[model samples]
Target chain A: MSNKKSSKVGGLNWAKLGTVAAEPATRACYDPTGVAITLEAKDEKASGGEGIVYTVPGKPGFLVKVYKRETLENPSKANAIRERIEAMCENRACQAMKGLAWPLMPVYGDASRKNLIGFAMRACKGMPFSSLFNGPASVKEKFPAWNRRQLAQTAVNFVKRVRLLAESNVLVNDFNPANFWVDEQCNVSFIDVDSFQIADRRGRPLVTHTYFASHTAPELLASPSALNRPRTVEHVAFSAALVAFQLLMCGYHPYSYQGVPDGGGCGSPDENLRAGRCPLGIGADCRLPDCWYKLWSQLTGKLKNAFITTFRNGHSAPAMRTPLGDLEFALNGLLITMAKDADPDRVSLNPCKVKSHEWIQTPAAPRSFMPRPAYPSRGFMRTPGFARPPYVPQQQYNPQGYGRFPTPRMGGTTSNFNPNLY
Target chain B: MNNNTNNNINNTLGNLDVMNPAPRCPVTILLDVSGSMSGQPISELNAAVAQFVRETQADEAASMSVELEIITFGSTADVVQPFTSMASVTPPAPFVAGGMTLMGAALSLAERDLAARRELYRAQGVSSYRPWIVLMTDGRPGDNWEPVAKRLRAEAERGKFMYIGVEIGNSADHATMCQILPTEPGPVKLQGLRFKQFFRWLSDSLKSVSASAVSDQDNIAYPSVASWADLA
Candidate 1:
C-alpha cells in the first residue's frame, strides 16, 4: 500500500456552451486606410505588467491589447504608440513578419476611436520561451512532441526572423525569453510590439530601454546611458546566440558553470557572460554531461570557431559578434549532423566475445608441463633458473619400477584428463 | 589477481567520471495545524499546498530543480513528508486540528532538514540555489521560539535562505510573530483565504529562480505581496 495522500483542490471549471455569455465591451479601431474595425471582447486571462489581453469575439486568430488606464496617462508614451501605428499602416508589410505578432490597427475606447490607447495584433498561441528551460515535464505538457531537435529548429526560426527584421530596417530592442512564444511545430512569434525600435513620423527612433541584463551585450550594459542608446544588429545577434545556446543545450544558459572563481574569474552566470567566461574556452571549470561534450567535440571546426569567437574570444567587442546568417548556417550544419547520428538502426557492434571455461585442461604427459614458446603455462609461471627438479624411478628396475610407485592410494575422484589447458 | 585489481580501479574511476549532478533548490514548508485551524483554514491550506505541488510539477524548470518538504506543527511537530523533487511530491492531506501549536519545533526541524539537504547537495557536487522556508500559523507558538527565531535570523542575514512567515487569520499573535520572523519585511497577514493566490506567487517566484543564474540574492523579482497578503 502506498503512504501517499490525496489532497482536495478545486478542479478547473469551464463555462458550458449552453450558458448565456456576458455582454462584451465593444470598440471600433481605425487604420490610416480609412477602414474601421469593430472589436468585441470575449475573455481575458493574460495580464502583464503593462496591460490586459482580451480575445476578439469576431477574430479567431487575433487579440486586442488595451493599455491600462495608468499607462495612457503619460501623453508622450501614448503619442509614440500612435505614431508607430500610423507608420505600420502606411508602410508595406514586411515578409519577415509572416510568423510574427505584428500590430494591425489602433484601438480606442470612445465611439470616435480617434484617440489611440491600444492596438490589435495577432495573438500568441503557445508557451513562452521560458518553458524551453523550464524542464522536461513542462516541455512535455506544452509541446508534446518536441525534442531537442525541435527546440533547435525553433531557435533557427528565431534567427531567421531577426535576419529578416534587419533586412526590413527594424530592430527588436528587447529580445528576451519572455517576449517570445513558440509552438510544437518550432514556429515562433514575437510579442510586445510596442517595444520594437522603429522610426516615427520625424524619422526619430520611437522607443528605447531594452537592455535586459542577462541577454544584453556587455558593451551596452557597461554604457552609462544604456536606456537612451539605440540597440544595434550586433546586440540582436548577441541575444539570439544566447537563446540558441539554450535551445541546443537543453536550456542551460551559456554562462552557467560549476566552480568557484580563481582571483579574477567570474562567480555567477551573469558575471561569466559579462566577462566572456565560456566553458568551452576560458570557463573550463563548467561541467556538462559526457555526452554533450562528445557532441560538442564532433562539431565542425568552423562552427566551433564561431562559438568561441562569439562567446569567448570576441565576447567583449560588439563588432566581433557572429552575424545571424552565419550562426544559422552553423546551426543548420549541426542539426544535420545530429540527425544523422539519431538514426534508430545505427547500432555499434563490439568485436570481442570469448567466454572462458570454468576449469583449465592440462596436458596428458607429465613432461609436457615444461614451458615452450607455442604452449605458454596457463597458471603460475616459474622464474628463470627456478625450474622444479625432474623425478627418477623409485624402484631399482624391479620390472615396472614397483608398478609406478603403487599408483599412490588417493580419493576415489581423479581425472585422467589434464585440468590446466584450454 | 592483476586483472581483478585493474577492474576495481576502473569501476571507481568510471563512477566519478559519470557523476553529473543537476542543481537543486530546497523548499521547506512549516505549517501550523493547530486547533484553531480545524475548519475552513485547514481545507484551504491543504488545497493551496496541493495546487503548489501540481503547479511546480507542471513547470519543467521547477520540477527539475526544486525539492519540496512539509513539516506540520499540531500537538507535536513532525515531518509528514521528507525532501523530494517537486515532480514527485505527494500533497499533504487535510489535518484535523487538535492541540497547541508547536511552531518552534517545526521551525527547528525545518532548519535541520534544509541544512542536511544542502550538505547532501554539496557531497553530490550539485550546485544549488539558496533554500526557502515558509512558516504559516493561525495561533501563537506553544513552545519557546526565540532560539530558533535567532537561528533563522542569522540564516536570512547571511543570505543562506529565503524566509517568509504567514498568519492565517485574526487569531494569530502578530506581536510575537513580528519578533519570531525575519524583520526585513516580517510576517504577512493573509487577506482572507487567498492561499491559492499566495502559492501561485510562490510557484512563479521559484520557477523564475530555477530558470535563472540566481547567485545574487538581489536579482530575485518577487511577485507583489499586495495581491494576496499585507505586512503584519
Candidate 2:
C-alpha cells in the first residue's frame, strides 16, 4: 500500500507513459511511380483501430492514412493491401469519381518504395452521415432549419454516388454511416474508399473481405465465407436502401421494433433480420415507437411500398431490394412534392402525427403502446427508494453556476496535472 | 380525414416526442463521494465524468445506443441522474463530496434499477446489449456490502451484466474491491489522478460495444488502458 502521491515511480515518468513521442525515423518516401516526397509529422488528424490519418505537409487537399504497425505485421497481408491500393490508383473510373476519397498514390515506408505502409487520399469535409440520422433534437441542433426536402436531397445524393460506384464495378461492402460525410447542402462524400471491393479491368475483385452484419443482407449473414466474397449490386441495394431509409425516417432502423410472432426478443438488428421479422412487413404484430409509426405513415405510398419490398420481401431475395435508380427517382419525386407544398410546417421528413394506431393495431394492451419516455428536466434528480433532502450547499459550492471549476492550488506541493495528456 | 380529425392529429404530433430506436446499452456508474474524496479527487472525478458524457454524445452510434445513469454514495446513496440517452443527456452539476461510504446501499440500488430497466426493455420489445455497472470508490465501505456483493458476483457469473470495479487511489481497499469484482479482469487502480484518461477509455470502449455486431459482442477488444490504469 504505497501512499506516495508522486507521479514518478521507479524512474518512470507516468506523465509521458504510453505517449508515442518518438517520431518515425524515415521521413523520405516514394510513391508507386518512384516520385520522392517528404512527410513531416506535425500532428495526427485522427486515429482509429486500424490506422492514423495525417495531413500531407505540402499537400493541403490530401490526407495520408498510415497503417498501424500491427495492421501490417503479416507480410502476405501487407502485399495484398498494397496491390489492392495500387490497382485502385491505376483504375481510370475510380480516379474519375469526385465523390470518393479514393486512393491517389501508394506511400512507402522508405525511399526504396518496397514497404507499402499506407496511401494518400483526397480529404473530405463534412459532418458524418450518422449525424443526419439522429434523434429529432440532435438533428435540429446540428442542422437548424433543415426540412424534409433537404433530407430527401441528401438521400438522393447518396444514391447518385452509390450508382456511380456500382457503374465503376466497385462495391462499398461496408455501409457504416461514419464512413460517409454529408455537407449542409445535402452533398455526400464517401470516405474509407480503400475498403471498397473493386474489380480489376478483367472483372475480378481485387479485394474483398467485408460483412457488417447490421447493414448486410440476411443471406450474407448466414454464410460463413461472406467476407471473402464480393458483394453484389443487389446486396449493395439493400444497404443503400437501409441508409436512405434511416436518413429519411430520422434514424429509425427498419428492424428496431418490438413484438414479433414469438415475443420479439430476437436480440440484435441482424438477428431480427435473420428471423425474418420486420415491423414494416405485412402481418407484422410488432409495436414500434409511436414516432417511428408516424414517420412510416408520413412516407408516400410508393416509397413506403419500396421500403416494405426491400426490408420484407428482400430479406430472403436479394433481387427484390429496391434499385438505387428507383430509390433516387422516388426521392426526387418526394423533393418535388415538398417543393409544391402550400405550408412550410408540413414540409418535414419527420411529420408530427398521432395516427400510429390507425397504422399498427397491436393486440397488446393500449397502455403498452405509449410514447417513449421524455428527456428529464435539468437539475431534476431521481433518487430511487429514498427522499432527496433539501440542498445544503457545501463549502466552495456554486449553486447558480455549472462549468469547469478553477483548479485549486496545492499548498507547498507540486500538482501532477498535465493538460496535454490527451 | 375531417378538419377536426386533422387538428387532433396535429395536436397529438405537437406533444409527441421522438426517441432513438437503436438497441439500448445501459451503463450505470456508482461513484463514492465519501469525506476522503474532498478536494482534487472530487474535482478530477467531476471533470472526467463530464468529459465522458461529451465524448459519448459526439459519437453518432454510441449516442443512439448508450444510456447513462449515475449514482453517488456519501451520507446516503442517491440516484443523482437517471438513465438518460446520450443524445439528450446534460452534464450533471458538479458533485459535492462529504459524509460516509454507503457502498452496499448504492450497489443494491444499482442492481434494482438495472433489473427494472431490463424488464422495461423486455416489455417494450426493445433489444439490449449486455448492461454495464461500474463501481468506483476510494475508501472502505461503511455499511454491510457482502450480501449485495455476493449477489452481484453471482449475477455477473450468470452473464446478466458486466461489473467493473475501479479503485480510485492508494486509500482504496483493494482486497474488498477484488472480492466485489469477478475473477477475470479484476479491479484496476487508477494511475495518479488520470480520471480523464480513464473516462476517455471508457467512452471509447462503450462506443465499440454499441457499434459491435451481435456476433462480435463476445470478441469486442477494449482499447488499452495503460494510459489510465495500473493493472498491477
Candidate 3:
C-alpha cells in the first residue's frame, strides 16, 4: 500500500501517525474542475457519530461531511434536495439581514452532476442535546447544572427565533436534533438549511416532509395531506417536545405525554436521537408498528378526550397542535416565571405519559457506539475491536453482523427516507 | 401462509417478467484480514469502507434496492454482515489484520449467503436480474480457493451468481485470484490504493442493475463505467 504521492497530500490519517504512502480512502470525487483542494483535518469535538469531519480545503472552515470511500453505502439523497435549499439559505440570509429571521444555514455547493456537498457553521459546540439530557452511557454521563430560570429564558429565545422564521414562511424541522445547534451562550441555530422554506413564497417544499420522517407528527404520517401539513403539526410538536424535555431536567419530569402515531417507516430516527433524546431502541425507531401504536394509545388513554377534543393537547385534532407563536410566548412566559427568582425547573405541567415496553429496555445500550460522528468509529484506523453481545445471537431475524457499527445509510425503512421522493 | 403474503408484496415491488427476487448482482467483498495484512491494510480496508459508504449514499437505485453483506477471513472466515439494505447496512466491525486468508471458508460463506438471499427475493415477489459476486482480496488464500472457485463457476453458469476477483498488494497473487472468476477479462489490480474507486465502479454497476426493468444476463450493465475501465 506504499503508493504515496506525498505525506500531506490530503490530511492526517488517524490510523497512521507518520507519513505513510496510503491509498486514497474515498473514490467518488467529482471535482471535474480539478480544483486544487487541500484537506485540513480540524480538531473536531469528540462526541457524535463517526466519520472524518473536514473543513473544505480552499473554503476556509466551511464544509463538513463524510466522503464515499468508506464501505458504508449511503444514497446521497441530500444532494438532490440541496438545490432548492441553497435558494432558501439566500432567502433566510436576506431575512436575517432584514431582521425578519435569524440566519442559521450557510451555503450549498454542487460538484457538476455526481453529488451535492455543503456545510453549515458547526451548530453547537457544547454537545448533542440528546446525549446531554438522557444519561446514555454511550454518550456523555452528565449535563452540567444550569439555573432553571436561565435555561427557560434560553428556550424562549430559541422559540422566538423559530416562531419568527415560521411566520416568514419557513418550517424548521422540529424533530431533528442534528439540525439544531445549542451554542455557548445558549443560542439555538438550525443547520441542514437545504430543507428551509421562504414564508408564503409558494411552490412545493424544497425539502419534503416525508424525508424528515421520525419527527413527523402522527397527523402527517397517517394522512398524506397538504405539503404544509407537516410544517404545522411538526412546529407545534417541536416546541412541546423541547419544553417537555427541558421540564424533565428540572426534576418534575412529567409522568408522560401524549404520543403521535407515525406513518410506517418514515426513516429519520437519527435526527430523533440527535435532537430529541430519543432512544435508538427498536420500538423508538422511525418505522411504525401496530404494537407501538397500541402502546401509545394505552399510555395516553386518560388524555384521549383532550387529545381528540382540545387543541391544547397536540394529539387533539389531526391538524391542531400548539401554534408557533404560542410556543414562543409560552417559552417566554416560562422564562419570565422562572426569572422571578423562583426555580424555572420547578414549573408545574401535567404529563400524559405514554409508557412503553421500550422505555423499560432503555437501561440496555443499543447496538453501535460512536462517541463521535458515525464515520470516524470506522475511520479511527483502530483495531476492528467488537465482539457480538453475549445476550444477542446473530440470525436472519436477528442478524448480528454490522448491527452495532454505524455504517451510515444502510437500507432503511422509508417511513421518511426515499431518495427519489426526497 | 406468511410466505404467500410476503410473495404478493414482492410481486408488487419488482414486477419484472422473470420476477426473480435475488439481486442481479450479488457482490461479495471477500476481505482478507490475515496476519500479513496488519495495520495499513486493515486501516486501508476500513477507509475503503468509508469510501464505499459515501459512493452508495449518492447511488439512488442501488441505495434503495442493492442488498449488501461483508465476510472477512483472517484466522476465521466470519460473516460480518448478511445481505441487507444499503440504507440500513452497518459497516463491518474493525479487524486487527490477523490470521490467514481463509479463502475457502469465505467462499463457502458467500455461497450460502447468495443461496439464502436469492430465496428472500423470490419470496418477496420482487423482480431481479442475474446475480453477481465480487471477490476483493489482498493475498493468496491460506485455505485453497480451488474448490470454492469451481463451485462459484457452477453458480455463474446456472444464472445465479457472477464472480469478479480483485487482487490488491504484493500479498495478492493475481493468477490464483483470477481462477476464482470466469476466464474472461482477468482479475483487476487495485492500482494506487483504488479500493474506493473500484467500489464506485461496483456501486455504479449495481445502480445500472437496479434501474433495469429486466433481470436477464444481457440487461445488466457492467465492465463499462470509467471506474471499471481499468479492468484488464
Candidate 4:
C-alpha cells in the first residue's frame, strides 16, 4: 500500500522493478543504553497492510517491522504507536511480556529520531499456528515430532501466554491463529505486538481496529456498525475461550455448527455468531460430528461447564462468561493427563466411526523401515529367489449375536484418549 | 465381543495405521522427452529435475510431506518412478529423448496414478491435500488429448486437484497447451530453459501449501511465478 519507491528492507528484494540497488540509505538507531546501531534498509520480499518488514543485520532472533512512510505522515497516529512502543520497551522486563514476542526497540528513520517508522520484535520462526489445525498431512510433515498430546499442550501454552499478557495489563484485542506460531517443542509465541491494546497515560485502553469474524465474540459481532471500541476484559476472555476451543477441539471454531437448518436459524457461522446461536449449546437442533461430541464428553465436568457457560449462558451477558483463568486451569489439566499417557504407537480413536469399525493408529516405526537418507528410493536390488511378501488386508468383523458393541477394555491392547484422567 | 477379541481387533487396526504413512501431497510430473528435446532441452530438464529433488529434500517440511512421481512421455508414456516422498526418492536417471511425444498417454497415467493414490489415502483414513499434476511438453501429442483435457478441466474446477501445463520452447504447440491446461493461469511458456527456476518455484510453492492448515488450504498463496515463466 506504500506508494513510495520500494527499497531493500533486508535481504529480500521487494522492488517493483525486481532489482536491488548496490547500496541503499542507512539509518542510525540507538539501543536503550544509547549505543549507536547502524541499520541498512534492505529489500523485503513480503509486505503487509501496515508496512514492509526488514530483517536487521546482526540481530539473529529479531526483525524490524517498518511502517510505510504514508503511515508516519499522520503525526498523531505515528505518535500513538511510538508511545506504545516506548512503554512496552520500558516495561520489557515484565512477566507478561515473557511469553510474548514483545517489541524490543523503536527504529527511527534518522539519527535525529524525527521520523518514526516501526519497532523490532523477536521473530517467530517456527511453523504458523495454521499448521496445527490445517490437517494431519501437514502436521505429519512439518512437526513430525508432534502428536495429539503436543496439540493439547499447545492449547494450554496459548492460554498461559495470554494469561501472562493479561497479567501485564495488556489486552490482545484481535486474537486469531494468524498472530500465533507453535514450535516443534509445542511452545507458542504471539506475533504482531503493535496491534495489542495498550493502556494510555489516562488509564484508558486503546481502541482495537482489527476483527476476525470467526474469532470475534458474539457481543462484538452484534454491534457490527460500531467503530473500533476499547476491548473489554470480557471480550478478551471470549476471544481466549474461542482460541482454546479451536486448539483443543481439533481446530473447530467454537461457533461453527453442523447440519442444515430448517430455514429458521442463522445462516452462516458469521450470522450464527452475531445472533448468538451456538448449535453446540443448549436448545440448539444442530448436530456436530460424533467425534466432536465424544471429545467434549471426555473433558472434565468443570471444563464442559466452562464451555457451556461461555458459549451458552454468557452468549449475551459479557459478565456471565467463564473466567479465562478457570478455562486455562481446565485446559492445563487435560494436557497434563495427555502428557502422562503419551505413547508413540497408541491408537487415538474417533467416535465418529461405527463401533465395529477398525480404529486407526499409526505406530512410530524405526528408521529401518525407511531407506537410508540418500537416493533410497532407487538402488533396490532384488536377490535371486527373493519374492515380494503377500499382502493381507486387516479383516473387519462383527459378532453375529452381539446386539450392542461391548465397552473397550482399558489396559488391554486397546486404549482410548481419556480426557478425564486429568 | 470378548475383551481379548476387542484387543485383537484394536491391535490389528493399530498395525494398519502404522503401515499407513502420513497424508501426502502427491505430485505427478509429466515430462515430454520426445525427439525434439533430444539435446539441450532434454539436458536442461534432466538437470532441473535433479535440482528439484535436491532442493525439495533440503526443505524439511516438503521432504517428508510431498510425494514425487515421474512419468515421461516419448514413444509411449512410462511411469519411471512411482509416487515416493522426497525422503526416500532416488536421483532419477537422466532422460534420453528419442521417440514421438505421447502426451495423452502421459496425462492418462497421471490421472490414474492420482486417483489410485487418493483411494489409498481414503482406505487408510489418512487426510490429504489436493494432488498436483504438472505437465511439461514441447510439442503436440501424437494421440487424442481432448478427452483427457476435458477430464482435467472438470476435475480442476471441482477443486479435486490442480493441473498445470507448461510449454518448453517456441516450437511447443501453445494453442494445444491452452486448450489442455486447467486453472485460470492457463499454460505458460518457460522463459528460455529456466527449468531449474521453474522446479524451484514448484518446490517452494508445494512447501507453502503443505504447511498451511486445512481450512486455509483452499486459498493457497503460491510463490511468485515471475521468476521463471511469463503468463500467456
Candidate 5:
C-alpha cells in the first residue's frame, strides 16, 4: 500500500498533526437541536486510537471529540455511531448522572446535517483510573494523601456510576482503565461514553463490539459470537467485580498467580479466567505474590467473601455474581470499619511491621542480592550497575525454574485460600 | 484460639512487607549510532527517543506496564538505558554518533537483557506480557551478524517476543534485516527521518498491546506504519 493511503486508513495522525498544538481551524457543524454551531477547534486535548479530543474556543465547559476521518468515511460505522450518540443525547436519565461525560449533541460535518463527525461533551478533569493502580511509590506521587479508604471509595464511586449506567440501560462494553478518570474526591467520570452499548426506545440493544478481554467474563470469552450480540447485566457484574478487585488490590488481577507444581499451567489473565483458576477459588491451588497475599488478607471478612464468591462461584454460575449494590454496601461498611481503626488515613489497610524503607526495599533487593559472575571483556561497560550475568538460552521454557518461593498460606494452616462457609 | 486464627497471625507476621504489583511489558530498543548518522540524523533520533518516552508516559496503562530500555551501537554496543518502568524512566543523554555500526553486538545485548529481565519477572512472581525488541538502523553492520540474526529469527518464530526492524534512510542494509526477519514482514524503510511519527505509532501500538488481554493480544491490529514508513 502507498504511504499516503495506508496512513489515512487509520484515524487522525497525532504525531504529524501534533497533540496539543493543532492549528486553529473553524468547522461548520450543527448541534443535536439542529442548531448551526460553528466550532473553532482551538487546542488538541487528547487523542486515542479512535478519535481526537479538541477544545472549542468559545465552549468553556465542553470538549469536542472528532471522529477520525476513517471512521466517518465508513458509512455503516458512521451511522451506528451517530445513532448511538443521538440516543445518548436524548436519554434524560443518562444525562442526569453527574459523573458520565454523556454526549450533549452530535456535531454534523456539513450543512446537510447528514455527515456525522463527532459529539461534544462536558470536559472532565482528573488523572486516568489506571494511575491509581500503579506501584505504591507512584501512587504516593500522584495522590500523596490517598489511603486504603480513598481507594475503597474510588471503587465505590466507580460501582455507583456503573450501576447508574445500568439503570439508564447503557452498558460500558469496554472497561479499559484509561476510559475512566477519577478526581481528588474519588468521583469517576467515564469518557468514551459514545462506545457504550445503549438500548433503544423499544428496549433493543444498539450493540457495540468493544470489550477488554481482561475485564470480560468467561462466558463471553468462550463465545466469539456473543461479543457482537447484546451483553447482559451478568457480564457487567463480572467486569465490575474485576475492576473493584483491581482497585482494592492495587492492580493485581484476581486471576494472576504463581503456578504451583501440581497447578495447571501458568496462564495469562484471560487464560486463567477461561480455566477458572482463581487463586482465591476452591481447588485452584495457585499462589499469589507475597504483597498481594497481604492485601487480600487485610480485607474485611465480608468484603473478602464477596470477592471470593464473585470470582469462584460466579465463574460458572453467572447469577451467583455479587450485585453492584451489594459491593457498594460492603465497601461502605469497609469505610466504617476503617474509621473505627487507628490511623484511618494510613497508606495500607495493614501496614507492614517492618520499617518503611525496609518494606519499600525488599521486593527489588532480590535481584541485586543474587551473586554476580565476573564480567567478560566487552567493548564498553553496560549501563552502570545494571549489568546482568551472561544470557544462557534455556532448552525448554519453564516458569517453575525461576526462583520459586513458597505460597503464603492465608491463615498458615490450609494450603488453599477457600474461605470457610459464611 | 483455633489453628486457623493462630495460622493467620503467623502468616501476617511472617510476610510483613507490602508491595504494589502490576503486570509488566518490557520493550528494548536497539538503535544504530554509526558515524554515518553523525549530523542531523543523530539529533532527530535523540528528539524522537525523547518524544517516544513522553508519549508513552502520557498513557496511564502504557506507563504502568511498559518497561523501556535502549541500546545504542556505534564503536560497540552500549547500554544507554537499562530496563526501567515508563513511570520512572527519564530520557537518556543525547546520543553522539562516532564509530562503525555494531548492530550484531547490540542485538545480542538486547536478547540477553530481555532474557534476564523475563527471568527476574518470573522470580518475582510477576506476570508479564510478550516483550518487544525494536531495531532501528541507518547503516550496515561492520561485524559478523549472521549467527545473531539466525538466533533472533528462531526466537521470533517461537513467539518469544515481537521483533520490529526499521531501516533508516537510504544507507540501511534492508536485505540484511530481511534475512534476520525472514518469516515476518521484511524491514520497513523509514520515510526520510520521520522518527517522531514512527515512535508515536510505536507508543500507540504498545499502549494497545499492554491494555489488551492475552487472548486478543495477537489479534491486535497495530496502527498503520504508513505514516512514517515507505511501504512502496
Candidate 6:
C-alpha cells in the first residue's frame, strides 16, 4: 500500500514528456519511427502528459496503456506485449495471477529520440485504487454485508489468492483496498500495475537506467548496501507491505503503521523513532493507529514484555534490518495473531488456512553477508542520448506525493484506469 | 471483450487502427563507391550487405516487418537492391569503384525508391515507419548536384524520406562535404571505412525493432561513428 496521499505536497511537470524532444540535425537511424506509426490513441490529461494512448480499441477487456513519449500515440509494441501476456495466460495459477496483474503491455519504443516513447494496449474497464476508496459510496454501503458467511468467505479467498502469489514468488507492490476492484462478493482483478510492471523495452536500446526508479520498493533506493549487492532488496519489502495491506483492508494491521504506505521501508525503529518525514518521507501527517503504535513502542521498550519485538533488541545493526527470510514469518505471525484475536464471526476475511509447516523457509543471505559490486563512475554510466537518470529518477514520483501521484481525470476520458473520482 | 465490440469500434469511429494493426518500418542503405573507396571500402560494404541479409533473415520479426532497400551511385545512379527482404536479397559480389561522383543521381534514386517502398509496404498489409534514404559518397557528386540536393530538401519538407549522406577521405573538403551531406540537413556520413560500422549499427537497430513488442522504436544508438569518422 503506497501512502494514501504522499502528503509531501510537491508537483513536477506532468506535461514534461517533451523534455527529450530537443531539436537535432538529421539523425542517422530511424529513431522512433518503428513505434510511432501504430498508436490508436486517447489522452489521459491528468496523467497522460499531453501524450496519446492507443489501445487495442475493440478489445474491451484486454489491455490499457500509458504512453512514455509523444511521436508515438500508437506503436507496434502494444500488440507484442498483449501477445506475450496472452501467451503467458495458461493455467489457473497464471489466470489468477493475470487477474491481479497490472498487465504488461508491449511497446514499440521510439528510442531514437533522447527520451524513448512507449506504446501499449489501453485497458478500458479499470480505475486506480485511490479513486475507489474516495468514491461516493461508503465502504460498508457500497458493499452491503452479505450475511456473515459470505463475508468470511470473501476474506478467506482474498488471503488465499495473496498467499499463493507469495508462494509463487510473484509480489505485488501495493495491494490494498483500492488497488484491486472487488465485486459484490469479492471477486477481484487488479488494475494500474504501475510503470514498474508495465514498462516496455520495444527492442530498441531500451535500457532505461532511470526507468520508473521512483516506483521501486522504497528501501532499495536508500540503501548504500545496494551499491555492492545490486540484488532485489525490493521484492521482500514490497511483499511485506502487500501482507500488511491485505490485513489492513480486511480490518487489521500486522503491527501499526499510522504512517503513509502503512507498511513500507521504515528501516529500523531507531531510524523512524523521531521522524520529521520518514526516509521514504511517508509524510508527517500519517500516524500509526494508536493500538499498533503503542504495541510497537512498548515492544521496543516502553511497555512490559510485548510480543512485538523485532529481530533486533540488543543485536547488531545489520541484524536489525528485517531480513527477507524472517519478513514473511513476521508478517504471517502478525496476521495469524490478528485473526486469532478477532471475533470468530469475521468470515469474509479468512484469506488463509495455516498448514503447520507454512512458515518454514531457508534463510536468505543478508546485505552484510554479501558485498555489493562497485558502481560505475557517473561518467561511465552513460546512456548516450538519454536525459533522465533512470529508475524513479527523482523521488518526485512518490505515489502519495501531491502532484506526482495518480489523480483522477475527467469522466469521459475513456480511460479504464483512472485514479478513481472519489 | 468480444469480437463484435472490436468490429464495432474499428468500424464505427476513429478506432480501426487498434485492431487490424500492422508493424511499419522503412529501411535504407547509402553506399559510397568513390575513387577513394575503390578497394577494401567496397568489399567491406558488400560484405556488410551480406551480413545484413543473414542477420535480417535470422530475425523473423525484422524481415517480416521492415521494408528494406539499397541505393548506390559513384559515376552514375544504381538501385543495388530494390525494396526487398534481407532474407531474399543476394548482395552483389562487390562494388569496385571508378567514376566521378554523381550523388544527385543516387539521391534521385533513393527518393524514388523510398516512395515506391512506402506504397508497397502499405499495400502489402504492413504499415510503415518514415522511409529512410541514405546517400554515401567518397568525394562530391559530379555535375552541379544542387538541383537534386534541392529535390531532397523538398521531399524532406514533406516528411517523405529521411536522407543521410557520408563524406570520406582527405580529398573530400569538409565545407563541401558539409554542404552536400549537410550534417544539419540531408545525409548521415560513414566517414571512411566506417561504412561497416554504420551499416552494422543500422542492422542491429533494425534487428532489435523486429524483435520488439512495442513496435514504437525509441532512440536507437547508431554504432558510434565517432570512432571511425575522420574528425577535422
Candidate with best DockQ: 5
Q: Output the lDDT of residue B224, model 2.
A: 63
| Candidate 1 vs. true structure, TM-score | 0.71
What are the per-residue Cα lDDT tens digits for candidate 1 across A1-422? 00011111111011111132322366455543545666555466455545667777667878777776556667877776677776765545641355576777767755466677677777776777866554333455666666556765787788778766655556777766767788777888888766777765566665566445667777766655865776666677778888776665545566654344453222445666766665653224455334434334444334554565566534665555566677777677656755886432111111022112112121122222232221111122234477533322111111222333223232232463211111
Residues A186-234 of candidate 3 have per-residue lDDT tens digits of: 6655544434543324444444443333334434444446444435424
TM-score of each: 0.71, 0.79, 0.39, 0.62, 0.79, 0.35
Stretches of model 6 off by over 4 angstroms after superposition: A1-422, B1-22, B122-125, B157-160, B182-192, B208-223
Give per-residue CA lDDT, model 2, range A57-99, as digits (tens).
7789898888777678878778778888888889766776676
Candidate 5: tens digits of C-alpha lDDT, residues A270-336? 7777877778733456666655665665566567656766787677766666666677677776778
C-alpha lDDT (0 to 100) for residue A326 of candidate 2: 70
TM-score of each model's B chain?
A: 0.88, 0.91, 0.79, 0.89, 0.90, 0.74
lDDT of 4 at A404: 25
lDDT of 3 at A246: 36
Candidate 4 docking DockQ: 0.03
lDDT of 4 by residue, A293-375 (tens): 55454454445556656776566666556556667776766666555643322213232322222221221221122222111
lDDT per residue as tens, model 1, B103-177: 888877776777667656544334677788888999998886788888887777566677777788888998888
lDDT of model 5 at residue A358? Answer: 7
- Cα-lDDT of candidate 5: 0.69
Q: Which stretches in model 5 have alpha-carbon errors above 4 Å?
A: A1-27, A38-42, A260-266, A343-350, A353-422, B1-20, B219-221, B224-227
DockQ of each: 0.08, 0.12, 0.03, 0.03, 0.17, 0.01
Error of 2 at B167 (Å): 1.7
Q: Which portions of model 4 show Cα errors greater than 4 Å? A: A1-63, A67-96, A112-114, A122-157, A167-169, A173-188, A197-301, A304-322, A335-422, B1-26, B53-69, B80-93, B112-131, B154-162, B211-221
lDDT (C-alpha) at residue B187 in model 2 = 70
Interface RMSD of every predicted model, in angstroms? 14.0, 9.5, 18.4, 11.4, 7.1, 22.5
